[model samples]
Target: MRLFEPNTAALQALKGSNINITLDIRNQDLADLAASQDAVNSWFNTNVEPYLNDINFNFIAVGNEVIPGSLGGYVLPVMNYLQKILDDKNLHGIKVTTVLPGNALQSSYPPSSGAFTSEASSVMSGILSFLSAKGSPLMINVYPYFAYASDPKDVRLDYAQFTAKGAVVRDGSLSYYNLFDAMVDAFFAAMEKAGRGDVGVVVSESGWPSDGNGNFTTPKLAGTYNRNFVKHITSKVGTPKKPGAYIEGYIFAMFNENQKPSGVEQHWGLFYPNKQPVYPVF
Candidate 1:
């Protein structure tokens, strides 16, 4: 679950539940936090320290898709401070990383020409260095829906939905049958080019919207995508680049959030706010 603050009762309920939690530091003042050790300490002390033993905290996401621009400069510093804090507190099991958007790359076609955008190169280098030092996986948000939406005429629905009848993309000897694997493999190739091939990858967010402006944004498709994704990850059939490697992932959201912006932003949820399933998942 995406955690912004410490909720005592909620955290208590998670104790012994066998559920892994990924805490997201959802604050806009990331630069200030990185500059101030006391702020970092206070934030962690109140939000994470008290619940460390109660919740199965697995990863501490420094930020979500806040890089490759003005705010990007603070990412590595913030992650470094957070990692240092965790190390000092003996929280070795919990990793520190940031969630990157697929657009962070300059190019991703063919999954072989993957590379970070020029604007993001310096920041990405630092982030990769920190992740490598900490032995943490690079968390990225991938959405095949956006890709298909951008070029529907060229992008087949079956391929995007992971039910491709034949290979839709061929990169050298590697043939890609679906967009999900292709997108992930693209990121893997980018990491390899960045000289961080040993670093692992994690899909921090991925899910299709049940309702949106697009024709494909239907409840049935959303359920199908999520269910297939669950099976894909659990089966240990990793992306072609890292075959058989396990890649951890999380569904985009659990409930439809009304606070989100209109259109597709508010629809990527498995359940309605009233606790009703939009469509059967799992």
Candidate 2:
């Protein structure tokens, strides 16, 4: 039951009505781009595109949280490959993107003044320009957990809980309660600093751990965080930082990954391994 049923009758029977496939290859590097692309292209062409072409099920997020790695690493070359792939395949509007870590932005405190780190400036500048030209939104993985976990004393517990005050560090005149909005505001600042302030920023991955120790990632807390986080995001109340931008954010994994290496990471799921809801999401 834990295994993914590739094409059983049950899967095919409910495919159109039940689910969508988002191909996210975060672990792949640029050097392996061609081989990976070929494999993916084959899969999509033979399996997904034909039946699901008009169904809006095809999405390719080329990379994830990779902006702070070594050179010839995640952000730069992959960005190049993403653009080329879309152009070559004529897959316009397919929503190709590379999600960056929050660290990519230097200013994240007050939410009003976020800037890309100096280390990221060289390639980030090119990326911002390219995304603007291609009309692709900047993708970011904002984990307020890391901030809290890194310095729990400094970060407010309630803010990380997604149901209370986060922190209030005003920059250029703006107040913030939670790290989520501050994260988004930082992205806006990154854009402005990059000289491409008009490009849209999208949240690729976010979530409150269902459970952890000492920090608020506990199982009981996880359920509360996920449930309220969804409500808060979907409500469109705007982040305390930016009051009017329709900041698009996507929650993290849908399933609890038992085999996912560590206990902490494996615990971050809305469902248990067998495609069952861990809690009532609806």
Candidate 3:
């Protein structure tokens, strides 16, 4: 389970549950948290400290996809500060990390050829170093839907949705039948190249839109993708690159945000605002 922020009500409701939670710092508040340790302490005291005993705080994501941009510089500092605070409080299990978009990679095709873009590499090195030393997984938002939608001519629908019958891409001896595994392996490959292969990855966000884009965005495709994704993760088959390794992941949205920018962005939800299932894969 994940919460975008430390919502008191949500934390209270989830208390006593066995669910491990990945709590995120709001993107807009990254500046404040980075600016002062006092701010971080106060934020934690109010939002996290009160619920620590009951809530299983597994990961505390400093920011989401804020790298390779203006907020890029703040990520590492905030992570370091947050780690110190967590250590001081004896919250060792709660890993401090940040989420990055798939675009962080300059080349991902062929999987083995994966490398972080120059823009992302400089920022990533420090963060990846920290993760490697602390034994924390890098949070990545993997969406094969976007890759397929941008180039349907080359990306097969079945492969993207994990319904492919046979291997679609052959890298070395590794046979990739699904785009999800391929995308993930690409990141692993990049991490290996960066000399931080010890760091694992936790997929922070992934989902297919149920509307707003021709046949690519439909309830059937979304259902198929999400259902097969769940099965794939639970199977523990892992990616061809790391066979049998357990993967930790979370789907994009629990409810559709009608207020998001028009089109596909508003349609990634598993449920409607009215709490109705959008074709139920859960």
Which candidate gets the maximum TM-score versus the true structure?
3
TM per candidate comes to 0.94, 0.78, 0.95
Candidates 1 and 3, the one with greater TM-score:
3
**Candidate topping lDDT:** 3
Higher-lDDT candidate of 1 and 3: 3
Candidate 2 residue-wise lDDT, 163-211, digit = tens:
6743465655566666677778778877887898877766767775665
Clash counts per candidate, in order, are 0, 8, 0
For candidate 2, list the clashing residue pairs, or say none. Answer: 166-177, 210-218, 210-222, 211-217, 211-218, 211-219, 212-217, 212-218
List model 3 lDDT by residue over 1-282, tens digit each: 889887878888999998899999988888888898898888888888888889899999988888767888888988898898888978888999999888888999999998898888888899999999998999989999998999999999998999999999999999999999999999999999988988899999988988878788888999999998888888888899999876798998888776643663548889988999988786
Q: Candidate 3 overall Cα lDDT vs. reference?
A: 0.88
Overall lDDT per candidate, in order of appearance: 0.85, 0.63, 0.88
Least well predicted 10-residue stretch by lDDT in candidate 1: 257-266
Candidate 3: worst-modelled 10 consecutive residues by lDDT: 257-266
RMSD of 3: 1.7
Candidate 2, residue 33: lDDT = 55
Estimate, for each residue in 43-131, the C-alpha lDDT of model 1 and write its tens digit. 88888888777778988888778777678888787787888888888889999988889989999998998999988788888899888
Better of 2 and 3 by TM-score: 3
